[model samples]
Target: MRLSERLRGKRILITGVTGFVGEALLHRILADLPDTTVVALVRPKGSLSGRSRMEQVLNKKIFESSRNAAGGTTELLEQRIDVVEGDLSTIPGLPTGMDIVIHCAGDVSFDPPIDEAFRTNVLGTQQLLEKIEASSPDTHYVHVSTAYVSGRRRGAIPEGPVDHVVDWRTEAKWGQAMRDRVEETSRSPGILSKLRKEAEREHRRAGPITAAQDAERRRNEWVQKKLVEAGGERARSLGWTDVYTFTKAMGERVVEEFAQRMSVTVARPSIIESALETPHPGWIEGFKMADPLILAYGRGELPEFPASPDAIMDVVPVDHVVNAILAAAAESPEKGKPAYYHMASGARNPFTYAKVYEYIREYFDENPFDMSERGAVRLATWRFPGGERVERILAMSERAHKIAEYVVTHAPRGERIRKIAREVDQLQRRLEFLRRYMDLYRPYVEAELLFTDDRLMELYHRLEEADKEDFPFDTGIVDWRHYMVEVHCPNVTESMRKYDVIRRRRGRSAPTVAKELPESGEILAAFDMDGTLLSSNVIETYLWLRMPELDRTERVREIGTMLRKVPGFIRAERRDRGAFLRSVYRRYAGADLEELENIVDSVLAKHVLERVSAAALRQVRAHRAAGHRTVLITGAIRPLTRPLEPLFDEIVAAELATDDRGRCTGYLSGPPLVGESRAAWLIRYAGQHGFDLTKSYAYADSHSDLPMLEAVGRPVAVSPDVHLWRRARKGRWPVEEWKTSSAANRLAIPFADELPAERTS
Candidate 1:
């Protein structure tokens, strides 16, 4: 069949669209069957990262061969796919006219809880089947089950029905509720009986089918050993080590029974290696054995293993599995019996795990990642057991954590304890100096010559049928070597980053540069306290901020209005056109800079309160009406800003400003920065004071006001001028106007304080 005819406007839905294998499957399916409509059933978390990841793979060069073979761009193929939000456990309210449903949503873990594992894999499959049976009964069911589900049996595990048995181990060992679930879940007679029943069901569903049905089977040893008491002894007697194989055994049994009525074909794919085509090369994510095996070889960990140097490990590319699935669906036998194909690797080209490791070693050396070898090791081992001996390594980590915690708590001597503590800390330095190998990375490299891809190649062949004529899904058209060499490797190599974290004693960092200005005996705050605090501008803040275009009359009137509202209050408009900025030294632009500081000391001593803001608290308290924390930051000396202190959790302002006579100067000396200057000052303040600027907020008026706005993670512009207005529009910032004196606002606030008027300049 032509690729287009194979699809022929067929509507299909596939799950796990974001995964490495899932992505490849979509590309291959769409590449071969151009007329098929593909929909991705993305998990909920898929919404978080957005489409960047999906796009990254689709944009690779490996698929160019696919394009040449199938002859189409990724964008052209993508237009056919629509993303759908759905998980295996949850049924999506899909449209009624769906044709085929492919259940590829599965966790790749060999070890998963039997119940939850089944819930996602087997049960999820059942749930999807239920949907098809109910909504789209005519929909064909194509399932991709792993080849390893053959249980750990030696020799050629035939492509046939899996033998299942009663899992008494699950029932006898788990809790009452868990046990009840096992009984609830066991719809099949048994694994062994279930496989035989599949043939019988096939005869009834259609006619007698020749192909053997595929069933999954395994013996869960991990669960029995750990969760179950005395599991070690039982596992030794039963001969199973991992729950993956054990649960898989049960899953195979489930499939045998479920496939009875549904058009099901299980593709038992063995150890899926990198990529076969579609997305290209090794477009894989997370850590696979190959990655670590190669990592170790580069650094030199394992030189050899127990396996034969040339024994074929039966590895197939993800693309091959997807192709097999597509093919099985296309070639549904007249007999309704579920077909199972054991996708094996050595059937064509024999390669060993040892050789695979060698290639990885060569790749690692040839393709070094960012960071030195130490960083590479860190990246290589970021899991529970990591790449080392699990139990031993965990014990060592616990010891280190315990020792670090103990040292931190034991340093409380007296006046001399502080000194002695510092001295004792030197021991860490000594220990570090003794450890020369710490910087050197570990070694245990695996060569890549072992990885072979014949099975995948077979799947890549797009061919014609007696009636179905055309190579629609052929990967032979793709350029695999070019892909693995150039494109896929770069994408995987540069995605993650690492950083160092340090612990410092609390309250010991230096004061922010802004905070230090007042104490430096420079600058001053000429606060015209009243109207500035009372103005509707401050209350409106981040929202509804419009920059005011001011003539000299308006600026002077604003200053005058503020002065009259608060007697004996210094008046300062938001500096730089309501920028709310001023120099740390109150350095007058182009003025004799030294003179300002010299005179500032004599002018600042008058303030008694710490920090003050009439509008901020009212707004916060209004938010309290809706429920929120209220805070304020100011440039006035502490005593001056202190009156509004109770209204806020934090009030960062100039420290107590003093004069030459050690008396109140009333001129408001010291660096009393406001607005953008306030924002810059805030950054230094956070660094010194250890504040969370990302979580904190600041409110101000005017365009120059934006610096302070930018400083805080949350910036609110209150009655800003033209500049801020232009910015907020371009930046798509939220805007709202809050009138402090408005009756509605006053009623909304829990504490009502009348705002002071603007002082005259």
Candidate 2:
């Protein structure tokens, strides 16, 4: 009988219809076995019901041909397929009288949390098998599993049950409890203290609120890392490669125990790639195992193939795997005994890592990836080093990149430093990705296992000649060079091209400002004073004020003193912005408060107003015209900021403490309006004045203003420094360059004479 003819009039239950392989299988059935009725078991996504989610799934491009073949998507869903609302986590009762069940769902992450792996792969499968035995005892079960269940063993693996002595029930229990244990250890005092220190170092300039959030984030990351490490250790101890395969093996044991009562067939496929012929050649949904490595090598990020040259790269096309699965489902084994099949290419027509590298190199050389201004990416000759040595090299490169990043980040701000910082950032991101890739894929690339697919081929030969022509599962006929270059390479590159365009669009599409400003008094517009609105910084303003009060020798001595302390100021600024401001203000010690006010009045016109950014002034005026409350929130001393008072409705500037004689005490009267304190103050002020923070706007340039910027709905980065620019880019916030006023524009400052008149009064 024809494969589709046997499947005709049968009722099938399929799981993981949303996943890549499951979706492809569903499409194949809908297109070929049009008479079969399918019940898809799906879990409700966030806001979508099961039926709605299935509708969305059918709308995917993979189902285009199937949809058209079945009259249309609506007709296919309404007349043929039924959506069952349930998940494997809690196995709802199976539909009655299922002729066949295709179990395709499991946690596919290579190193998921141990508990998740067990919950989805081991316990989930156990529940399904139990339910099947209870509700639909006569159903033929086809479980889709990976070929790598052979684990760390390196030899010719046969198509049969895995030999094991460990109790699967006990292993599942241990794996499920691993996360709780790791999380408890992560909460220990020593670990928390270490995480706290790291967080403070990274986010101190942003604020205490941000630092606390960072600490919590790091704690979660630590717990996750420990869980992954524990899972890997447990798997390796049990002779498995990862949590995925370990749990999968446990699932097979569950099936083995259930096989005494039910008919079962296990189909194991190795490294499924893009389609070769079925459903149109080269069709793919996402990048799979070898695609990342190939793309990385083509981009010149990976200079070496981290694998033995002679190791078999056992990859089979997805269409072949799908066909083999249908064939397995069609041939039901005798009750109380299960059949095993390996849908792989290694044992039939072996392809080595060396050949894969050569084919990919040839493809990329003919069709190179263009990198805009840098020209086309050139592929380098890759050395086939073993995984361990390559990992060690990557580790060394990461350490060196970290050192370079630290130096460049701390260096003085200039055009050259910015350029170097960008390069360092790119290298850091690339290194991080490469490290993660190596960690996840090292075992697979270095493995020496070759799966024998004799049983699978025998099943194919049993099919009638017409069935064989219509549904082919033989991997021996695939030309490795043609599949790698003509099919897989183009598919992966096209997917990557689409992703790159979407990523670039996301980075460039952040809205800079609202098209129409709402006229409301409850809306606030906050501006950082120095480096944001004006080109002058604290040091320059301090020099202009204090320099004229001293003799030539005293001026030289004061200048030398400030220059010597600049390095310390820079370090403090990076660690804590408030501390830096405090240290800088200490230079005002013993100077008369009245004298400083006088000096500011004299220098306020040429030294300060001339450096004001005309573009920033226009923004402030626009905010005022929109009936919004305008405020200047700065770390600069109050006396020096008095001249800019006319431009703001309120000024939250720092104040110096004075003694009975009215001389400066070189200390702030209260905490400086910087870092987290500024953010806290803004929140309190908003509460008191009934201002809506979600409608408020903030503009700043320094990293210290991150807290304030994040507090508002609209945050603009104005002439930002290296750290602030990077943060803005990460957050997709608008960045603007605010230039200093020209000589002609300086005379047009709003209420320029009002400050001197007020001081004289």
Candidate 3:
């Protein structure tokens, strides 16, 4: 489609420039078209906040692909791309004299209120129109709209403006969803409340589940909760599922109202999925509910889902949406009637829901992660009398009620299937227990929503037609089938890799992380809790090292080991009825803080010799020699106290609680010092005594420490984790990598038997 002509030297402005779809459009425009200038209008923010999400979007190919589907990459387009802060609701002043203005900004809500849809979509368009009119520039405006404007049309809805009467059928179908949302909201005070309730209730049922399950359970406990959450019912009725589109319908109407006098074109695409064509294929990001659901189902996350295998699910790639939008805008006549572009088709290319499932399943087979299979006997779900799959699913639902019936009547790790049953039942019970006592965010996943993707074909074909030379569109060069399987799949995995930690950052100020700690009448040299001294991961600690002799097994595990104990650890839990736990509870009920400290000190002084990083310790003593007060301001607990004590003047381990007698009774008396809390304490200690945190230096390995890291005058992250690493890169924090055990570190090790000479932290 001759995209070369329209894109030549065009200056375009885009709203929602940082949004999922907007980013795609921006990327496409930037990468494909030469001499094109794209200006982005983003919602503003304060300083010291998360770096522009645009960076995250731009950096990742998955994000880039998604953005490409809507548009091309601004960075690659070789055009001057300017990001201007603004929102759709209010049109902030834009740079004057733009050749093409794509108002891709609108309230993209799933179930927006009629008034809000009018205000943000319609009124927002009105505001943009007014702004453009006032400027009186030779700008061709392209408004991104949705294909759902059919408003509940039963048959295949065509593209273009039609005076189709909006009757009771449309209103009734859409109205049901709103009513359901209202009903759901009425049940719970808030969204979190509902999720928590569902989680709590699900926590009681028998099944292997994640946090989402518990949340679903809590929400489902109330029958009406599902019905009230907007698009569930209405989505299915319209042959296009999900609430997002329903709200978008209102947006389309708004565009129609405001596009009359403007040089506008409306691009209506349905269920804009990942990129079909662009720099890459199937490049998707954002771990939406879909991924979790799929992963869970694959890992037996849910007992069953109510869905029709035969239901048609059509999705257009992001680039097609972008292609149609760009070409239509380029083809727009002066003062056009909002050039309507339907971005759906089945004319020649037919991608079915069943085929999609097959493709996804095959992709999983080839690009498998370290997903563990059910380890034992298969979980035996309810056996339905009817042979049909639907009947079986329904039967399982009924049986799920009695999920906990066997918990009181089973052995640990029974049969594999039984184990699953036990696990789900136990998890649900634990969830219930926690919900009854702990402060938790409740999440409710509404059920009973029928979602569809009927007009997807019509939209795609229209977009394909727009791609023809008459209108002209080019989605760069992307392979759809392979892209989805290989490209997008890996992108999702990588983003979620190591819990979504892109990279770790090392900050400046290595010397600030002191070896010698501060004590009374001593120069303090403190090491950061996470990175400089100990490894960044605590979970890895327990996993790699043997649990303390006492903490060998859950039965005998010490409440507080080397690390300072949290308040909750000290409190006796009554969830278990086992005598073994009860006996331990009695032992922990009355513990002396001083005695506990002594126990931890002995372990730190002897057993846990491997915990200290020798090179870091050597650096500590050098500070002491240099007359700096060496202090160990760590998040470590008593027993897990490190090996480099003598180098420091005093060790400020995480604070612990004490009994009246001060013997090691086992429970913590107070809060543990860690992260920001630890920072706060350090600030107070320095202010009251004679320390200057700002002038002093700090070291760590986690990005979560960004707040505390900044508080210190010098922030250094050695061997940083992903978050910290990213910050270090962005904030330009200096990083140093060194071995923990060095020959010069001999003087730093307080104990004779330190971590093996060759061992490194």
Candidate 4:
């Protein structure tokens, strides 16, 4: 009999109907076997009602063709699918008289807390088994499990029951104990008091409490850390990579407990990806195991991957896995003896890491993801330098990331630049997370996990020719090269394209010129002072200059204050640079404004002017000669720009607020003109002074000046950063390199702070 013919008249209880596998199976069953009853268990998401959440799933594109063929209406779908509003963990029992129970839902997170993983994977499976025994004792149970339950083993993985070291009941008791401890410790007055006392002592030593909410946060953080450590250590001891797998193994053991009472089939699929043939090829939902890495590579964000070139990575098409699952469910195994099928491709059709790398290169080379207005990015050539090399690279990357973070934290504050720095920090942190993920999946990806699929192949052969066409489970028929290049790659790129994440990375073609330059010549020429005219940052130079004057006691106190702020400073910059810049400038409070101006003038004469970029200086002179209104725009305080103030017709920069005594109050009188803020300021200033912005010229060297560059008709980049360089190329903007290292070296200024050696500009 055909697969669909056999499925006809069956009442199936399907869990995880919103998941990739469950959704695909539902579509298959409803489209192929119209007579079958599909009862889907959908958990209410957040504030969404259960039926509302089910409607959301039904609206997915994967269900489009199925829905269209089956009456093509929501009412028809409502009639066909019985949506149950429930969770597997808490559900008392499923609907009675169900012919088949397909348990597809479980926690798939790699690092879920031990108790959470067990509660969802093990306890949930146990609950389902009991429900089946209570409501429908004769119903067949089809449990979808991952092949990685083999857990860090080598050679050919067998198609049979898994024999784990820990008893399922013992594991369950341990999980309960952990939960009890967590709840007990949370309410314990002694523990909470100790944590609060320690936090209070640390706060007293640090500084004045800036916010009350922060006071209780550290104590909670410390307590949570201890809980996580305890769970993580226990997970590791179970010989599994994470709590997810260990609990999944326990889940299988729970299934074994009911093997004698009913017919049970465990379908283990290895690294299931997008569908190959069924329900439309290359159809995938959400980011799966390797999708992030693939997307990152397409965007040129991923530079290196950690894996051995020749490692056999077992991957299976979603359709083929689903086919195996359905076929396994149909099989009549001997009573009290459950059937096991390994739904994988490695044993019959294998794709090595090297082959995958080659396929990706060829795919991108032929059909590069069109970032549209954003200039195209080339995917890096993946290098698989073995395990040791990967660790070495990670160590180097970590050190470099730390150094970059340090520079961003201490660098002179420019709101725009600070915002960009924060983005850089976030990207670096993501890279770090990816590196850790790579470590977690390294053994799985790099190992020779040759799964034997003899029983799966047998089931395929037994299917009639018509059934074979509709439900194909044979991986031997898949063309590895074609599937990787033409099928999988395009699917991933298409999905990411819809996401719009690829184009948002600093590349967009310049907008068309809207208005011509004013012919009568009321042109504004905006010059970015710090990196444009002045080779060094004035604020940083001033800080170094002032460092030597502090006494030992004052120096020690200041050092402690700065050290205590390092973590918050980095995080603040990442979250919001404007706020970070404001916080940074606030440190100058109580210093005499006039004294700082005098110091700025002396510094400009002795150190700043000579280091001014010769190329920039010439351009400024030319603008002045042309009768254009010259403006010096910098994030530095007004006093720091005083020495160079005479050269410009008007100065636009951050101003320090002064107290009644004329000392710095360390607050800005207005918004600091940095990054996009600079552009806003320029537009306002131009409107007030009757200067035509369309006729104006702007100069800057960083990506933060993107707004200013886009604001004016003629924008120039001088020794620009990487992001700006890419933007400039795409926008056809002028770029000039300036050299001022020798001029900077000519100064004999003494500095007390042991600053990192400066990079020559």
CA-lDDT, candidates in order = 0.46, 0.85, 0.50, 0.74
Candidate 2 lDDT over 409-524, as tens digits, reads 67766556767887889898788778878888888888888898888888999999997887888989999999999988988898676776776676557547665678998999
TM-score of each: 0.47, 0.93, 0.50, 0.66
lDDT of 4 at 170: 86
The candidate with the higher TM-score, 1 or 2, is 2
Per-residue lDDT of candidate 4, residues 1-761 (tens digit): 88877887888889988888988888788767788888888888899966787788777776776667765647646668787888877775578888888899998877665677778899989988998899988889999988888876778889987656688888777875776687577558776676566544333211123112234575456445555555557766876666677788889988987988888888889888988987787888877887777777777776777778888768789988877778777775654898888888888888888888888888878877666665677788877877777678778878877887667644654444546665766678667766767766876776767889998888889999988887888888889888888888888778677667534542343332223333345898898876778776543554543544466687668767876887897666444445766887888788877766655554445466777877667777777777888899887777767767667998987888999999778798887776667888899988998988877888887666777878898888776655565567667777677667573674354343333233111
Model 2 pairs in collision: none
TM-score of 2: 0.93
Displacement of residue 552 (Cα, Å) in model 4 is 28
By TM-score, is 3 or 4 better?
A: 4
Among all windows of ten consecutive residues in candidate 2, which has the lowest summed lDDT? 746-755
**Candidate scoring better on TM-score of 1 and 4:** 4
The predicted structure with the larger lDDT, 2 or 4, is 2
Per-candidate Cα RMSD to the true structure, in Å, reads 21.3, 3.8, 13.9, 11.3
* Candidate 3 worst ten-residue window by lDDT: 439-448
Give the alpha carbon lDDT tens digit for every residue of 1-761 in model 3: 44656577777888877666777777676566745777776666564122264454566654454345445554433335666666666667777877778877775654444334445565566677677667745678777777655554444555566443334234534454455565456456587576665543322111123334546555544444344233445544543334445445644555565565667676776556666546455555454324443343233333333333333333456767776677666665556466666665332244443454566566656654443242322221322222245335444644663555445332222134344544555556544432321211011121111223233333334544434533223322334457557755556555544442322211123233434443333233456644467433332333222222233354134424423433232231111112222223234444444534444455334433454576666666566667666666654444345455666676776433455566444444454444455567667777787776656656665433444566677677666644345456556665555344433233232221333443212
Query: What TM-score does candidate 4 reach?
Result: 0.66
